[model samples]
Target: MHELTTVTDSAAAQLQQVRDLVALLDDAQYVRRPPGASSVAGHVRHCVDHYAALLAGAERGTVDYDRRERGGALETDRTLALARLDVVRSRVRALAPGVLDRPVEVSGIVDARGTVARSRSTVGRELLFVAHHAVHHLALMMPVVRTLGVSVPADLGYAPATMAFLRQRDGGTPA
Candidate 1:
C-alpha cells in the first residue's frame, strides 16, 4: 500500500507540475512547434494518453500501450488537458491496494518486424511504468518550456532515484 501510494502521489505531483506550467502558456506557446520538435501540447497529450491507457487496463485485465487517442483537443486546449489530468489523478489515488498485485496482460511491439508481444504484468508494476513514462515526457518538455521562457521546478521531471541522488549530492538528505 505504501509503495502504491508513493507511485500515485508521484504521478499526481508530476501532473500538477504540468498543469502549472501549462497555465503559464498561451495557446500559441502551448501549440507552437520548433523545427523537428514536438509541441508542448503534444507532449502533454502523450503523457495523459498513457495514464488513460493504464487506467483502462487497470479496469480490464489487459493493457495495450499502442491503443491511444491521438491528437484530440487535449493537445490544444489547456483547460481540457487540466480536466483530464484531474480525472487521471483522482483515478490513480482511488486505486485499491488489493488490486495492485493482480495479474494483467500487457501488449506492445517487441520486434523489428513490428510483431505485437504480450506478457504478464501486475497493476502495481504498470502504475510504476506510467509514472516513469510521465517523467520521461516531462523531461522532454523541459527544453520546450525553457524556450518559451517558462520556469518549472528543478525536480519536476526527475525520477525518484534521480531526485534522491541529486539531493544527496547537494548535501541534503535523500528525499
Candidate 2:
C-alpha cells in the first residue's frame, strides 16, 4: 500500500494479489467448482485475460476486451496460471511512467446481443480498469475459496480505492 502511487504500480499490486490468492490453492482447488459458482480457475483466467489484453493493447494502440483466451491452460493449469501472473506483474511493473498517458483505442461487446462499443482511453486508464476488474472477480472467488476450505487473507482482492479509503478510515488497511 505504501508504494502504489502510479497506475502501473497499482496494476502490479493487483497481479500480486492474484498471486497471493493462487498460492493458497492446489491444482485441484484452483479448478474445483463450488456448486452453482464458477471455478476459481475460471475467474482467475478471466481476470488474467483482461490484463493480457491491456498489455497487448498498449503495444498495438487498440484494446479489444472481448479477445480473450477462453478455455486456455490458464483456466486449468496452476503452473501456467502462476507463470502468466508473474509475467503480467513484471510487465506492469516495467511500464514506463510516460506510457500511462499515451492515447489508445478500446472496444468491447456491451450486451448479450453482440453489440460492440468503442471508446478512447489511455494505457494508464485501462490498466487501472483491468486491475479493478480483477478485484471484482476476486471478490466473487473469495466465497468459492472459502467453500473449498481455503483460508483467504484479509486484504486479498480488495479494490485499490477501497483500500485507500480503508487506510484513511482506520489509519491502515482493514484487518
lDDT per model vs. reference? 0.82, 0.87
Backbone-clash count (model 1): 0
In candidate 2, stretches whose alpha carbon ends up further than 4 angstroms from where it belongs are 1-5, 172-175
Q: Write the per-residue lDDT of candidate 1 for residues 62-116, one digit (tens) a residue.
A: 9998899899898888788878888887888888777878889999988889899
Candidate 2 residue-wise lDDT, 1-175, digit = tens: 3222377887788788888899999999999988899998999899889988988999999999999879879888999898989998999898887777788999999999999999999998888899889889988989899998898878776787788899888878756
RMSD of 1: 2.4
Best by lDDT: 2
lDDT of 2 at 101: 79
Which pairs clash inside model 1?
A: none
